[model samples]
Each structure stands twice: as C-alpha cells, then as structure tokens.
Target: MRKLSCLLTGLMLTAVPGVCMAQMTADTRLGVGHSVTDADLRAYFSIPPSGKGLPAGSGTALQGETVFTESCAACHGEQLQGNMAPGIGADKLIGGRGSLATNNPVKTTESYWPYATTLFDYVKRAMPFNAPGSLTDDQVYSVVAYILAQGKIIKADETLDATTLPKVKMPNRDGFIADPRPELSLYR
Candidate 1:
C-alpha cells in the first residue's frame, strides 16, 4: 500500500506541470486579439432623416388602407388608438394635434415627429412588431400615406414616394431646436 501510494504521488506530480503548461499555451493561443473591418460592423438596416435610405417605390393612402387592414390593425387597434396591457401594448398613431403641453399628452406622429423621413425610417426598421422589415417599399410608403391621411396631414389621394415623402412638412416641424447649452449664458 505504501509503495502504491508513493507511485501514485510520483505520477501526479509528474503529470501536473505538463498539464498546466499545456493549458497556459492553449489560453495564450486563444487570446482576444482580433480585428473587425467596417464591412463586418456595417448595419444591415438603417434609415436617415432625409429619406436617404428609402427604397425605390411609391404608394398612396388608398393603397395603405388595404395594407394596414391586413397587417397592422390587429395589434395597433382598428383606429391606432393603442392597446393597454400590463404595459402599453402599442402606440396610438393619431389624434394628438395640440396636447403636448397638457398632463395627458398624446404623442403621435401628427403631434410629435418633426420629419416625414423619420416616419419612413421607423416604419422600415421595426414595425408590424411581429414581422419587422417584411413590408415591401411600396407597402411601407402606402402605410405612411395612410397614417398621414389619418392624421389629417396629407390628403388620402396624395402619393408617397422617396421624392415626395421628405417634402411633407409635419405640423411640429420647428418644435425641436438644437441643444444650445454650455453657451455664454451658461457661463454667466
């Protein structure tokens, strides 16, 4: 028993150093020292504020009504009034024209969004919640047209394309001002 114990001890001590060195060598080889190019980090989807990323298509409010009825009405409500769950299920897309200063403000596209481009970008990125980026460019344009029509910002017959979308002035066009903090006034 004593001889066996000595043999086992001798074997363990001999094996330990080799194992430790092998582990260290492996770890060094797997160290975090890699480079990623711009292409690797590029965004798969993005929309600029100038409707720069809008695709080549056009649609009208008349077309959008069909798309909205088919794809969006279930979650966003029949009139885009918003559904309330444990949290707000969906955002109301209309009927907040002059309610920003009030306690119960309704911040819909008509009342809040300064740029039509922002609307196009947002709808293109994450909408229909369940099936994002699923709408064709024409469908997206139509939906925007429909929402704009509902908001009373545009006529139902107006066409919405990349060229015309950016020109649609929202009511709150001048609502936002560039941050002017840390100026001469602040120093005083």
Candidate 2:
C-alpha cells in the first residue's frame, strides 16, 4: 500500500510539469493569427461620410442600373421597392421624401440618409443580399448614382466617384443633428 501511494504521488508530480509546459506553450501564441499587413487593413477599412478611404473608381447611373439589375434586383426588386420574402426583408431605396414629419413615414434612402457618401459606403460594405463586398468600387459608385438618380436626387448622366459623390447633396442632409456628447471610439 505504501509503495502504491508513493508511485501514484510520483506520477502526479511528473504529470503536473507536462500540463504546465503545455499551458505555457499556448501562451506563446505561435501559429496563431498573422500580423495585420497594410493590405489587410485596407481590405476592411471604413469609409467616412467625408469620402475618405473611397477607392479610385468612377461609375455613372446608366452603368449602375446594369449592375443593380444583375446583383441587387433579387432582393431590392426591379424598381427598388424591396422584397419581403419569408425571412428576407430588404429595405426600399426610394420615395418617402418629406414624409419624416408624417406618422406613416417610410425611411427610404432618399428621405433618411444624410449623405450620398454614406450610401456609397453602405453598398461597398454590404449589398447584393447573398454576396456582400463583392462589387467593385466602380459598381458601388454606379449603384449609388442609380439609386440617387431614381430618387431624383441627382441627374441620371452624372458620374459618381469619391470626390463627386461627397459633393452630391441628399434631401435629408440637414435632417440629422450632430451629437453633443464627445466622440467615443466604441461607438465608431
């Protein structure tokens, strides 16, 4: 019994170091995540309302209609009225102008969005229902131009790029008031 007790004690003490070494190796973070490269950061970078970080590409409303028909029409509908398919609820993109004051105000892009640049950023980040971030910069710009033109916000022939997109005024541009509280990184 004494020998058996010592033998068990010896095994436990021997096993403790091995377990500790395994934990220590895990803390080393070897074979974990790779360091973030410039390209990596650029891939998921945010586009501000000022049009900063917008990629270098140009697209017109005419070109945007084609892209929209192919990629966006499935969820957004042919006339951008949105699809309420079972679980999929796509938002409408136009109309609702001056309806914010009404009880039945529809919060479409033309009536709610404060900036055209924001529209471009949203399409760039997420769109096409199933395939998000798949559209090229030109496609994104064109789509924004088409939606804006459809909403009568801009001329159909107008081209939208980083510089021109920011300059395009939205109907509700002054609708939103700036936050009085100090900016916080978490909110951003």
**C-alpha TM-score for every candidate:** 0.70, 0.77
lDDT, candidate 1, at 167: 89
Q: Please report, in order, the local distance difference test score of every candidate based on alpha carbons.
A: 0.76, 0.79
List all candidate RMSDs to the true structure. Answer: 16.9, 14.2
State candidate 2's TM-score: 0.77
The list of candidate 2 runs beyond 4 A from truth reads 1-35, 182-188
**Local accuracy of candidate 2 as per-residue lDDT tens digits, 113-188:** 9988878888888887698889988899999999999999999999998789889889999988878776664552
lDDT of 1 by residue, 32-123 (tens): 53342322222243556677656789999989999998987877777978776544378889888778878988899988998888888788
- Runs of candidate 1 with Cα error greater than 4 angstroms are 1-45, 86-88, 181-188
Name the Cα RMSD for model 2: 14.2
Using lDDT as the measure, the top candidate is: 2
The residue pairs found clashing in candidate 2 are none
